[model samples]
Each structure stands twice: as C-alpha cells, then as structure tokens.
Target: MMYPPIHLPIVKVTVLEDRALVERHAEVVLSPGAQLVRVEGLSPLAVDRSLQAQLTGGSVAQARLHRAWKQKPREGSPEGKTEPRRRVDTLEAEWKRAQVDVQRLQSRVEVVNAAREDVLRAIAEFAGAGEARPESWHEQLEAVRASTTAAEEALRQARQHAERTRQRLVEAQAALAQGEQPEPLLVTTAELQVEHPTGGSVSLRLTYLVPCAVWRPAYRATLASTGGGESVTLECEAVVWQRTEEEWKDVELLLSTARPTLGAAPPRLVEDWLRLRDKSEQEKHTVDVAVREEVIQKTGEGGAHQTEELPGLDDGGEALTLTARHRVTLPSNGAPHRVPLFAFTAPAVSEFVGHPEHSPLVHRVARFDNRGPAVLLAGPVELVRASGYVGRAQLKFTGVGERLALGFGSEDTLRIVRQADVKYDTQRLTGRRTRTHLVKLFLSHTGERPVRVAIEERMPVSEVEAVEVKLLEEQTRPPPTKVSEEGILRFELAAPPRSQQELTLAYAVASSAKVSGL
Candidate 1:
C-alpha cells in the first residue's frame, strides 16, 4: 500500500573517521488508533538492525522496519528518472543526425571520385586517339588537367568531412549508450510497523548507522611572538567530509575515531609454521583455486555521541570525542566542510636549531607544552609564524603536560659556520692510538630581535672496553643540558641582535688496539 511520505530531519550525527551514526527527529499525529507509520528518507546503506525508533507520549509493543524497493511511476516520481530519459532521447536524435550527415558526406565523396575518374578517362582518350592539334588541343589538355586536380581535391575534402562526421557519430553514440542505462531501483522508504497502545502527537526519534560519512582531524597552528615575552600562541581546527545521502541541517555534530567495518568481534588467528630451509633444495609445488564468497550480517548499535569531557582528554584512555559547539549543516553532495572545533593558546619557546652534517641552514623550532586540558590528536599541522605561513609539520598524539617541538621553517637571519679538525697519534710501546677531534661553531644573529638557539652535537660511544673517550671541559663553551649517556650533547645559547658568538668542542678518543672509528 502507498503511504504518505514521512519527513525526518537529521538531528544529531556522531562522525567517525570513515563512518557516522545519524539520528533524525519527526513528530507524528496519530488518530488514537493502531496503524503502521512509515519513515522514509533513510540512507539505503543504513544498517537494517541499526534502524530504531524511540517514541514519546506513546508506547509501542512491537516495532519493525521493512525495507523494499519501490518502482518508479509512469509520471513524475521522486526518484527523478525523467531527466535521464530525456537526455537519452536527445543524444539519440543527435546521433541519428550525425549518422545522416556522415552518409551525405560519403555520397558526396563518391560523386567526387566518379567525376575525377571521368576527367582522367577523357584526358587519356584525348591524348591517345584524338588527332594532333595546336593551340586548341594544348588549352583543352590544360583545362582537363586543372579539372582533374580540382575533382581529386574535392574528393579528399569530402572524405575528410565524412571522417569528421563519423567521429561526431561515435561520440554521440557513446553518450547515448551511457544515457540509456536503466534507472536504478532505489529503496525510498522504510515502513515501520509499530503496535501502539495509544498515539497522540508523538515525537519520534529514529537513529541509524550509515556508511559513506566520514570525518578526519585537521589542525592549523598559528604562532605569535613579540620576541620579548618568550611565549607563542597556537590555534587548531578540523575538516569533515560526509556523503551519507542525508542532509544534516542544524544538527549537533560529534566526531570520534571508531572502526565499524571491522565488526565488534576480534579477528580469528591462523596457524603459521616455521621450518629450516635446505640450502641446496630447488623444488617447488604450486596450486591455484578460484573462490567467491559473500556474507551479510546485521550491525549492532555503534558508538554514542560525545557531548562533554572532550576538553580535558589526554592521549590515553578510550577513544576521544570532539563535539561542535554550534549546529552544523552538511549536504549530501560529498564535499569537504571545515568546522572550527576548539581554539586555545599555549605558551611556547621559539629557538633556532642547526645540524651541520645535514645542511648549513638553521631551522626555526618551537618547543611547546600541552598546557590546555584538551589532548591534540595526531594529524597534519600547518605552521604559521608572526611573519607568515612557514611550513607544515605532523602533530603527534600529545597528552597533558607533554612537550613537543615543531619546525617552523628555515631561518636566514641566523647564520652558522662549523669547522672541524681531526688529529691522530700512536704510542709505539702500548700499541695504543689517540684520536683528537676539535669542532668550532660560529653563530651570527643579524636580525633586529634577540633569539635563543639550541645546537645539538653527537659524540661517539665506545662499544668495547679497550676504547675510552673524554670530553675536554676547558675547551668547550656553554655547558651542555641533559646530555644522554648514548653520546648526545645539547647546548642552549642566547644570541643577541647584531652579535656573533663562537662555540668550541674538543674530544679525544683513545683505543688500545687502534680502533678504526673515532
């Protein structure tokens, strides 16, 4: 039986990385009788078991959702198949016209060829059997030659026109073929049979899990530093995309990271055996088989929509949830829509870092702590300094009170020149060798603002007891901070405007058996 269409407007959406849970609200005015109320406009990809209805001011003893494909009417139906049929008719007409044009051009080409052959035959007859004449014969021969050449050119032009017409016909035929495809049988409604006790203007909420809706986390970090406060500000944002064949207008949007396709059950384990291979074996056996399998299962209720506690979340715990502060409207056109989730500023220290072994350029780095209550998810972060957009970096999952360093870009105002020298000496009596290495770093800050620079240097760790390495404290400048036992030295330097500073590091390696690496 054909029932009246139910209008269900999306109310809330819980978006995951690749899927979303959609909820809709609709009010039905019943006549205080028992009847089947059908809810239309649900996603065709919606899980059948996930279809649920919660009613207020009424009680339902039995509830079931029936999904069926409804055929299109001969008249204008909601499926909108008339436009495609019209397009197919138009393409067919154009294709027929193109075919007629091609045929006409081909006929013209044949006529031109016939005329050329006739001229050639006339010229051959006149040259072979006709009597020898003077000026009149020469004039006639020239006329025949000119006519023959014109006829041949006309034939070539006609053939080219025919080819062009054929190409048009091919294109039109392809378009007509595409347009002639049968209209898909789409599921337009889900008839809900609810055994109601008593119904009177009930507000019904229908929730379902649909595929093709996804949301990903994107961040934007904007830095602002006056060079005297020793702190920088950071901002973050998110981008979401959905195409669930339903418009979420003025809806509460909640984003989560969940995998529904993997199902609630864990994966089954397969046995794997390890065997020793024979070095001289060169035999193999192979088998091939074709198999096709399909399994359909009803999906249970997905994750819930997150409302609060999103601001104080750390990287640990269960899945995180971020809710939009305001209502969001996303059409079912499969497009990316950006929404500002939250923005907070944190204090950061800006410094310049350099690695002389990789490049001579110094990169601007920002060391910031997650002082805010919200945990920043791992995603691509675009960095923008006070000057302009510097570069892009990846923001790993950071918890509260966790420190992170991000590279802003290369700095040209700070210049670093590194020089190194190595000398080796051997002791003949003990068969020991001493290798001395000295490194000099010249740092110049030409900018108008003073900056902090951190230089990282690496020292070789002795793997054997016969090798001993020592750092010369008298020759080194600026004490190291938090040096690791694995031979890593970090030095923090304060660079003033228009000033140059020199840093020296010297280390000696002594090995009893003359080590190859120093």
Candidate 2:
C-alpha cells in the first residue's frame, strides 16, 4: 500500500501594506526546533489507510501530519541580518520535507505488530505432534489483538506529534535567533483537525521508543568419551523495539518451564478426561405406609426430600466439551508480555467466505513409519495438513509452491529397499524467541559387518522444521540399534556392510529461537 505525500501550503499571506502593522514593539514568540536546509516549503506525510487498518486490525487508526513549517524573509529587510533569515528559509523547506517522513517512520510499528501476529499464528498452527508444520499456531487463532495494535499506533502518533511540535518551534526560534520578533503566526486550525477517512481515528497517545536485547549462550554438553570431544557454539542475536533492548538483554529464564495449573485454570487434557463414569437417575424410590391393625403410621422415616436434578444438564448423549487455552508473550520492559487467553478452537469457518480454512505446505507432508511400504497421502490438503511430518518425495525437497499432497514411507516400503537412509539440516529459528529444532545423528549394527546407506532429508530451509526420508519401505527387521546409546534422536542407514541385518533410529528436535541482531 502507498501513502500519499503530505502537502501543506507554505501559506504566505502578504502583510496589509499598512506601515503601522510593520511598526515595532510587537511581542514575537518564536516556535522551537525549526531547522535550515529546505525552501519553497516541504510536503506533508501521508499513510495508507487500508494497509494500516489491516496491520492494526479494526482497533486503532493512525492519523498523522507533517511536522515542519516554513517562512520566507520580508522584502527590504536589513542588510547582514539576511544571514539568519537565509538559514531559517532553508530550514522551513526541510520542515516541510520532514513532514513527509512521518508516514515512513510510523508505519514500522504497524509492520512489526502484523509480523508478530503472523509469527504467533504460525507457531501455534505448525507445532506438530512430531515435526513438519511451518509454525505451531494456526493463523485462525482468535485473540484480543487489540492491545498489541494499540501500542503500535500509539508509538506512531507519538513520533509524528513530537516531530510536528519540534518543526513549529524551529520556525519560531529562527525568527528570534535572527534578532527579529516573530509576528503572530498563522496556523490553519482546519489542518490541526486530523481526519481519518475511515472515521475511526482514536485519540493519540504519547509513546517512547525503547530497545530490547536478547542473547543465548554458546555451549554444548560434554559426551562421555575416551578422546577430547568437540562442541557446537549456539550463536547469539537480539532485536530492538522501544524498551525491548533494556528488558530482554539479560533474559536467562527458560519460557519452557511452567508449573502445573489446577482447577479452572487448567484445560482438560487427554488422560484425566478418560476416567469419567455415568450414574443413572432412571430409578425412583417409593415409600410404603405400614398399618398396624387399626392405626397405621407413615413409617420409613420419610423418603427424605426428593432430589432435584442439576441445572443446565444436557442428556443428548453428546460427549463432554474439550477446550484448552494458551498464551503468547513477547519481550517487554524486563517482563514477558502475556497475550490474553486464547482458545484451542476447532478449525474456523468464514461465512463471508465459505468452507473451513487450510494451512500452509508444512501440513501437506506426513509420515507413517511402522506401517506398509507406501502410505498414500491424498491431495488438496493445505500446508496445514502436512506441516510437521516430512518425506514428501523419495529424493526431492518441498520447494517454494504451496505443499498440496505427499506420502509417508510405510513399513512395507522400508522392507523393499536394499539400502535406505534419512538426513536433514537444522538451524536456530530467526525473528522470534520460540522453540527451535536441532540435528543429531546415530548408527549401529548387530549382524556381521557395518552397513552402508544413504541418510537424507526431504527439502531445504525454505520449509523450516520439515524432514523427508526415503528407504526400502518393506523390511523384515531393522538393523539392531538402541536409541539410548545415541546422544540425540538421529540415525544413518549406511550404503553397504561393515554392518548388519537390521536397525532403527529416532530423530526429533525442539523450537529454534530467532531474534534481532544488536
């Protein structure tokens, strides 16, 4: 989206040719923060409405104007005094130009917010049971996206207002510095009234730009070995927002750590939900009066009060509802900013646009390891379907285009291959601090000699956290191997022997963090 340039008129109104108006003794108060460099007046800045609205959502609308004002020297002014007026003239023009700059500067907050939302959605949606989806969170996540958007809009306005005030002051200052009092400056109150085409402009608020810093140490675990082992250094990086740098610079706590929540706070998990049993209210109790010859007594000490049914109980034979919530926090001034609770809602439907939605290519790829030689993955699944599971093509990778369909290697498929292997590259995630996947490899044999095979991956980093493996699908048994001995989940099926009959290896990883650079 493009923002129209701000074009405020220099608005030179000729003085009433009366000598009295030009007479001295007029008190001139110069506006502050004016500069020199531009003349002929600078243009005002503009913003793209639709784009800003989309970025900030429906919550806050940003209204900004150019910050600088311009003034020309009067004809027949004193000699040698022209030096400062010349300077002021140049600055007035610059002020006009700076006015145009407001949009560019303010737009960044919107861009960052939009990016943050997208990233959050991606993380939740792609978080796979194993690995494959691009980001864990689904884009359809319903959230109170208001606060984040507001913060961004407020920041933009703060910047624009500050700059505008500075510009006006600069013009007034120039007149004073030049040894002449400033006449009553004419400011168009109409322009002072900020107009939002959407008509939803919120009252602007003051904002401060603070920097955030983030860092992760470079270290690796020492493996028990006879020789001196090596280590891989985890690189460090950080991003700066207003106050973000100050807050996150020393973040050492692991966000992964959490205490168990009980009662209402915790959502229903799979295990606890299973132990439920039903008690039927179908049977009713009756009271019988005992008659002792002539006189009868209503015995049985009263059948007690009839039990009232519980309110809001539905007996449609429907299953209990399952809802879970998760919150996402970003780096703030020394504390993580927790977003409001978000539900683990089912796939969403848009009546305005029919049908349920589909995720990106990451979901299209799936793997069925223990089954047959080839498990056919159907087509038309969005990336959401194959997100985490890998192994799209036997040898190829998942390229740029959206992943529509792919298949997994079944147990039968493994048996058929004379030689098979799985391998892929891994790196720390960039931009946000979230879970990241790492790489580890292992191998073993039980029969005679060692085995030689091709261990590999499906695609490149174009699709983060995806793995693809192609091997002899049908196998009677795997080469004997224990995952415990292997440092991390990884394996290499060799090409030939020095190896044995069968073996199995497991591979997995966690979130890689991305951060801005200092």
lDDT agreement with native, every candidate? 0.70, 0.28
- Prediction RMSDs, each to the true structure: 13.7, 39.0
Candidate 2's error at 493, in angstroms? 3.9
Q: For candidate 2, lDDT tens digit of each residue in 421-473?
A: 44334454442222222222232233254333333222111123322222222
Measured with C-alpha atoms, the lDDT of residue 249 in candidate 2 is 23
lDDT of 1 by residue, 429-496 (tens): 97688889899889888999998888888777665666788887888886677576767788888999
Q: In model 1, which residue pairs have backbone atoms overlapping below 3 Å?
A: none
- lDDT accuracy of residue 332 in candidate 2: 38
**Candidate 1's error at 220, in angstroms?**
1.7
TM-score, each model? 0.63, 0.16
* Local error of candidate 1 at residue 307 (angstroms): 25
Off by over 4 Å in 2: 1-88, 91-227, 235-240, 243-492, 496-518
